[model samples]
Each structure stands twice: as C-alpha cells, then as structure tokens.
Target: MTRVEINFDGIVGPSHNYSGLSLGNIASTTNKGMVAYPRAAALEGVAKMRHNLALGLPQGILLPHPRPNRDWLDALGTRPDDVPETLRPAAFSASAMWAANAATVSPAPDTGDGRCHITVANLRTMPHRSHEWPATLRQLELAFADTRHFAVHPPVPPAFGDEGAANHMRLAAGHDAPGVEIFVYGLRGGAFPARQHVEASRAVARLNRLDPDRTLFVAQSEAAIAAGAFHNDVVAVANGHVLFAHEQAFEDRPAFYAALKRLLPELEIVEVPASVVSLEDAIRSYLFNAQLVTLPDGTMALIVPGEARETPSVWAWLEAMAAGNGPIRRLGVVDVRQSMANGGGPACLRLRVVADPATVDPRFLVDESKLDRIADCIASEWPEQIAPPDLGDPALWARIEQARRALHALLELDALL
Candidate 1:
C-alpha cells in the first residue's frame, strides 16, 4: 500500500476571464476586464503536471465544470433570456479553475471510518463562485465514487460558510500517517468579509469524523485577511511536519507555535518575519500559496508561480531558503499568470489528495501519456484568448463547449449533456 499525495489541478476553462468578481481577491479586482488566454493557461497547467511527472511525482487533473452555468441561473430564478448585462457575462466565469476550493479532504489514516473523506465547499462568499458547489459536489461524487475506499460528503450547511482546503491545513508524520488537522478561521476581519467561519471549520472536522484531540482550531489574523489573505492559504501552508507562514498569519503567533509543538513535537515551523516578507508582498506574489511537496528523495520542493521569480524579495527568500541546507532544498517555478490574475496561484489551482491512485476514478489520474494528450487537446482546440466582452457572444459558448467535448473524448470521460 504505497500512499502519496496526488495533486489534481483544474484545467483552466475556456471562459476564463476577469470580471472583478471576487471582492477580497486583489488581483481579480485589479485585473478585471483583461484578456485571458485560455489556451495558454491550459497548456501551462498541463506542462506543470508533466513537470511533476518528470520528477517522478504522481499527479492528477480535474476537468472544468461546464460553464456559463445557465442551469444554476435557472435555479436562482434568473431568466437566461433577459439577464441584465452586468450579471450576464459573469455567468460565464471560469473561476472553477481554482480547484483548491473544491474540497477539504481528510485521508483515511485520520478518519474514524478508515476511509478517505472529501467534503465539497459551498463557496458562498462570492456570487460568481457561489453556484459552483453543485458542480463541484457532482465531480467529487463521480471521481471518488468507490465506497469501499472513499467517502464523499456535501458542503457543511450553507449557513456555515466553509471555504474548503484554502482555509484548512493538515500536518502529518508522513503521507500515510495520522497527524494534526488545523482549521484556521477568521471570526471578523476588518471591512473585508471573513470567508471561513469558526462554526464552518468545526462542522467539517465533525463531519469528517476527525478525532477532536488531534484537531486544533486557530484564528486567522484580522490584518492578514484585510491584506488580501482572504483564505488561510494566502498566508500559511503546511506540508508534512513543516508549516511555512508569514509572521502576521495568525492572531497569536507564538502561542499557535507553542500549542502545535506541544501537540506534535515533530513539527518544523518556518516563520517568515514581516520585515523579510510583508503580508502585502506575500499576497501579491503568493509565496505562501506555493505547492510545497516532499519529493521521492525525502526532500521537499516548492512549486512556485513564475511571478515569485520576478519579485526580488520572494526570489531572494527562495534562494536563501534553498541554500540554508533545510529539508526544502528545491524550487520549481511555473507560469500560471492567467489564473494568478484572478487571485489564485500554483497551489490555488490544485486539490491535494493523499491516497492510492488505483482507488480513484481512472479518468482523474494523470500519467506522462495523459499529459501529452491533454497538451495536444489544448493546442488544437482550446481558445487562444478570451476577453470579458466575448462572453456575451453566442459563438464563444459553442467553442468553449466543443473544446470540453474534445477533452472528454481524449480522456474518455463521460460526455457532458
């Protein structure tokens, strides 16, 4: 039983564009109405998946949910025929490209039932993203349907406001070992609304059947959230026993570390002082959102965004960190600027699930061969670029729909209706 954490990156959807939909997401608001190259975005994503494969890391992919999700509009009692211009184009938003918000997964080792548990996020914070829960739930149910190995649960009731893995972090002795689960919540953060509710985090822990003793609830700092750390991942991320975070990431910094050390003595806490890396810089470059993975060689690597390489402070920090002879000795930078413009980074674009690949739906698994085919699909069928104004054009929808159909055929996924 070889256990590994497989990254399932969301294929950037054709309707990918900037609408300034997310209120607290600075990038999304700043770059709204800009031209987004959907074709390039997917190609870049596939290349990243292939990069991991070349490193002998197991990877997986998640298909974009059918977009211009008119069905949801119908459910919301909005007539598609006469949708107001402001909300009309927003309907075609492809924000689902950020799969990290897809679910909060608790591996089999930590769950009471001895089965991997996945709970989809309601994503009720932003209007453009609120309708994504149903599609996300459907995908989770389809991809992890093996009852013998996995358990898929719905989002905690709507009133609780759970933002999924973006607000959750799991630290374990190893991929296959049980360890502490940290549920970070923002009680009330300045003018910018706090996305993760304390109740929401508790609900997920209870629903996932996580042992209370092994779980810890931490408060997200008010300053951090207002500084564009809308989700905890924007400020903190944990891999194995290591937690890499900014100094201002939590309410009581020293106390959080002391408590974690008390509970999990093996914990390796890496604190980046505010002087070294300001919260604003961290949010802009998404340094904390980098995917930190333990390679097969028993050392870790930070899969960062290309933007980090351009930022002097972040790049300097990476160089120093890699040179310090720490367990994290490698850096892999990838270009995901299109997704980044919409307030997501390399880590934001993926959902990490630790389990045997054979236990998941084969269509969701990625191998070298599958990566090649996905690249081919992107080059041949995906749109070159998508602008905000293009969303209202009927032909754009047709092309987007056809591109997904081609991808389904290539991957042998079930056809979308």
Candidate 2:
C-alpha cells in the first residue's frame, strides 16, 4: 500500500478583488479597495503549483466557486433586482480562492470505518463568507462522492463557526500510520474574534471517529490572534511529524508539545522564539505561513512567498535553518504578491489530503498539460485588473462568466455548468 499526500491548490478566480471582507486579517485591511490583477494572480498561483511539480511533489487543483452566487443571494431572500445596492458586491466574492478553508479531512488510516471523512466548513464568523458552505458542500460531494472510499460529512452546525483545515493539523509517523491529531482553537482572543470554536474542533474529531487518546486540544494565544494571527496557520504549520511554530503561538507552548511527544516520541518541535523575531515581524513577513513540503527524496523544503526575503531577520533565520543540520534543507521562494496582499500566503492557497491518488476523483487531479491550458486561459481572458468599484459593473460580470467557462472547459469539470 503506497501512501501519499496530495496538495489540491485553489486557482485564483477571475473575480479576485480586494473588498476587505475579512475583519481580523491585517493584509486584507491594509490593502482594502485597491486594484487587483486577476490574470497575474492566477498565473502566479499556477506557477507555484508548477514549481511543486518540478520538485517531484504531488499536486492537484480545486476550481473556484462560480461568482455572483445567485444561489446564496436567493437563500437570503433577495433577488438580483431587489437586493440592496450596497450589498450587491458580496455576491461576486472570490474568497473561495483560499482553498485551506474548504474542509478538514481525516484520512482512512485514522477512521474506524477505514474511509476518509471530509467536514465542509461553515464559515459563520464573517457575514461575507458565511454563505459559502452550501456551495462548498456541493463541490465536496461531487469531488469525493465515492462513499466506499470517502465519506463527505456536512459541516458542524452554524453556531459553532468552523473554519476547516486552517484551524486543524495532523501529525503521523508515516502518511498511513495512525498518529497524533492536534486541534488548535482560540477563545476571547482580544479584539479580533476567535474564528475556530473549541467545540467545532472536537466535533470534527468526533465526526471522524478519531482515537481520543491520540488527539490533543490546545488553545491559541490571545496575544497571537490580536497581533494578526487570525488563524493558526498564520502563526504555525505542521508537516508529517514535524511542528514548526512561533514561541508565542500557543498559550503554554511547552505543555502542548510535551503531550504530543508523549503520544509520538519522534515528534519534532521547531519553535522560533520571540526574542529572535517579534510576533509583528512573523505576521508581516508571513514567516510561519510557509509551506513545509517533504519532497520525493525525503528531505523537506520551505516554500515561501518573496515577502520573506525582504525581512532581514526572517531571511537570515530561513537561510540558517536550511543550511544547518535540520529537517528542512532547502528554501524555495516565489512571488505571489497578488494573493499575499489579500491576506493569503503560499499555505493559504492549498489544501492537504492524505490518501492514494487512485482513490480520489480523477477529475480533481492536474498535470503539466492541464496547467498550461489553465494558464493560457488566464492569460487570454482573465481581467488584467479589478477595482472595488468594478464589482458593480454589469460588463464585468460577462467577462467573469466567460473566464470561468473557459477554465471549466480546460479542467473538464462540467459540474459548475
């Protein structure tokens, strides 16, 4: 049984814009209402995926939800003509481009029934994003419809406010070995609301039937979230058995890892102390958000956004970490400034699934040929730039529609049509 983990990255949509929809995210607030280049954004995202493939990493693609989601607008009891003029732009949001929020997946190795379970998130914390689950569920059901191998579960009830994989992480001895599952949540986290409810994290574990003894629940630092760590991924990320994080990321950092080590003695804890780099620097440079990928040769590489290079402290730390006798021996930096400006880093654009590629729906996978077709479509039809005011232009809707149709044609995903 060959075990593999695939990263299904979300394509930056044609409707990409900076509406400042997310409240607690610093980059979203800072670059709100600015002009966004959708073509360049999507191309950069494709290039990142291509880079991963060149490194012998497994990669997949998830399409963005159709824009101007009339289904969502209709669900709220408002027709296009009668909807409030001020709120119309919400219908065209491209927030689904951030794939990490799509769902939290538990692989077959840890489940009692031996079937992977995917809990689609009900992003209830923000009104702008709350309407997404209904549509997100439709896609999840389509992509993972094989009940024998996959069990796609509905979201935890709306009141709990689940944000999916961004708030959850799994660490195992091997891809197939049943190891520890870590659920990180925040409570009364300063001015910004804690997006991941503790109950939601517990519910996902319960839904998947994970072993309680191996599961660890930890609280995210109130200070971290207030300092712009809106989600755990903003301050920490996990890959395989290694946990890379900041010193102030957790409330009691030592205890969290100690308990994890008790469960799996090989658990590697890499913490960047605040004395070395401030929390503000971590958030600004998105140092903690780097994608920690284990390549084919078994050595690890840190895939980071170019912003990291500009920060002297972060750049020096990464250089030393890669050059020294550490698990991460390489650093791959690429430009994704378009997504970065909108509060998404390299990790934000990808969703990780642990399973054999043969078990997943073939429609959801990607290759070099498909990447070229998607990039060609983006270059030919995607709008060069989108401003906040442009969201209201009726002409913009037609271009968006055409762009999506072209992509759907290339990916052979007719479910959207």
Candidate 3:
C-alpha cells in the first residue's frame, strides 16, 4: 500500500495579528494571506482528491502534529461565529484537550482501518521545564501508540542560538530508526543566533546522521547566502548535490554557481528559478504544508500552498516540482476561498492520511461530468448535516450508496480527464 504522510502543527491565518503586534510574529502575518488562506479552501479539495484516488487503489496516510501555539484557536478567530460551531470549543482551548488526553497514546482517534496515526505533543512554545516534560512525553506516547514504527523528534527551539536544529536532528536520525527521532537543539531559555550558516550546519549534521548513503541536501540560494556557509556546510555535507532557487541565481548566479563548482566540482546542482512556482514564502511563515506524493505510475505530486485562488498561484509549486523531474501526473488545486475567508487552506483544514495512487479499476477517471453527477447525487442524499437536527438518516444513507455506485462507475471510466 502507498502511504501518504503529513505534519499538522498549527493553523495559518490571513494576517499575522488580529489582537496586537505582541500577539504574533511577522511570519504569522505572511501565512495569513498566502498559506493559511489557501489551505482553508483546499481542505475539501484534498479530500476530494483522496476520494478520487481511493476509487482505484489501496492507500495509507500519516499525520503528525508539529507543535502547539499554532493551534486551531490561534489560526481561527476567538469568536464563536468566527469558527464552525463544531470546532469553536476545541479552538478555544486545544491545549487543555491535549492535556486531558495526555495518557492516551494516539492523539487522534483511530479510524478502525489501522492505517492512520496522530502524534500529539505539548505545544512546543510552552516552557520545557521539568513539569512540562511529563506532558510532552505523554503526548509523544499518544502520537505513536498504534503504529509499529514512526518518526518522533523535537524541533529546534526558535529561542535557541541555532536555527537548523530541527533539520539537523531529522537528518541525523537516519531513516532506519522506526521510532520517532527526538531533536534537542539547545538549552531552555537560551537565545540562539539566526545565522543561516549555523542553521545549515545543523541541517547537514542531521542529514549526515540519517541516510548518509542516499541523502541529498538542497536549499534556496537566498537562504544559503543569508547563512554564509553555503559551500562549506551544505554542499560539503551532501557531497556536491544541492538545489538552488532561481531568484538566488539572479541575485548572484555567477558567484553562487562558482561557489558550488569550487566546493564540489562534480556536484549536481539543480536550479529552481523564483519565476518557477515554489512555496518558500508560505513555508517561512508556517502558512502552507507541502507533501511529496508519488503516484502509481511513478510520477510525483507536490501539494503545497493549499488554497483556493481564482488564478493558478495555488498550484504554482507544481511548476517547480516538474522542473525537478518530480513524478506528478495530475495537480489537485484546492479551492479554499470559503475556508480562507474564515481562515486556513487545504493544508490547514483537513489532515492528509493517504495521497498515493490506487490500484482499483482504471475506469475511475471516466468522465468529469459523470463525476459531477455523482457528486450531485451524493450531495442530495447526504445534505450537509449541521447540529442536532441534521444527524445521519437511513434515507440519506441509501442515497449515499447510490451516489457511491455512480462514483464507482465514473472511477471505472478510463479517460476521466
């Protein structure tokens, strides 16, 4: 079975601060308009995409909660009407929710199919005092309960002097350790320098620790320049292979290229221009979540900047992926305008469990119109159920079955596009 894995940390909003400057960081603001906004709309888009895939194959999904503070409450507004009623309470006090279930191993309820796992950790922003360690450990335990093997690790604390701690830990753990890799960057309450080289070195160290034989290290040119150790640390660690963004080349392509050549003469440097689609901006501010999904045909899909945009910006990352020779046959651009108006994008709203291609009948892609018809039938049979009066009904269930059949027929179609 093909497995789809994702990280679910906090929610992203359109603007950084609704309360005051003291309430959030600059990245929070950027995420609001770009990552968070689009993700809200794209949640359904992702679900639909998954539904489409399920029609033809067997798939599994992995979900991880990066940390707290970026919780739903922080992303969505505090007002009752600001969030869907079902989510309002959870949004208000998600930390309490985490604490209450600290003893439980799985952060999210099991889906019964034994294909999903939710890792929960105490909000990373919280003080890592002795008192907090137990809860943190409990959260980790919950996150890895059902799975035979999983990844675990701490993030580089922003307050720490080093920036690349998280990346370093991830790389050092190597892919062989079935358990979650814990990353410990610095001491508690210490201030870390934000230099890029320091961060890059940490990343290199981690990479060296993890998959030393098969790992490749890539970074944006701008990020490399900012750190000043681009050649010595990043290139040296990966043995000559590096990925650079186009804008980085534009600013000082000659110098950047020269540096790579001198450090690792035979290095295979992949250049991704700024003009090409990318989610660098989104990722910086913790707005969008990007995942690399491989299809049954061996093509890859990069789903990022998950939002609903009138233009094609949401799927811009695909261009970059294509340039890198990623195997992506179809692009699922999520439309999360409604969700964004409130808050979030595809990455924010729904957690991705599985995104690999399925092995069912090739007919699933039959006709877009037929799929639409099936959607309509499903909608009619299962009208949006909200509140007590809108619970599931037998009639609705029957209609859902009929819609499912229609969906199956469409799935059976060979030329769906």
Better of 1 and 3 by TM-score: 1
Candidate 3 yields a Cα-based lDDT of 0.30
Tens-digit per-residue lDDT, 42-123, candidate 3: 2343354454354332322121112122234345554322435343322212122112112111111122223322222222
Q: Which portions of model 2 show Cα errors greater than 4 Å?
A: none
Per-residue error at 336 for model 2, in Å? 1.2
Worst 10-residue stretch by lDDT in candidate 2?
80-89
In order, the Cα lDDT scores of the candidates are: 0.87, 0.86, 0.30
Cα shift from native, residue 42, model 1 (Å): 1.1
Off by over 4 Å in 1: 415-417
Q: What is the C-alpha RMSD of each candidate to the true structure, in Å?
A: 1.3, 1.2, 13.3
Give the TM-scores of the predictions, in the order they appear: 0.97, 0.97, 0.39
What is the lDDT ranking, best to worst?
A: 1, 2, 3
TM-score pick, better of 2 and 3: 2
Q: Runs in model 3 with CA error above 4 Å?
A: 1-140, 146-148, 151-271, 275-289, 304-326, 337-417
Score candidate 2 by lDDT: 0.86
Best by lDDT: 1
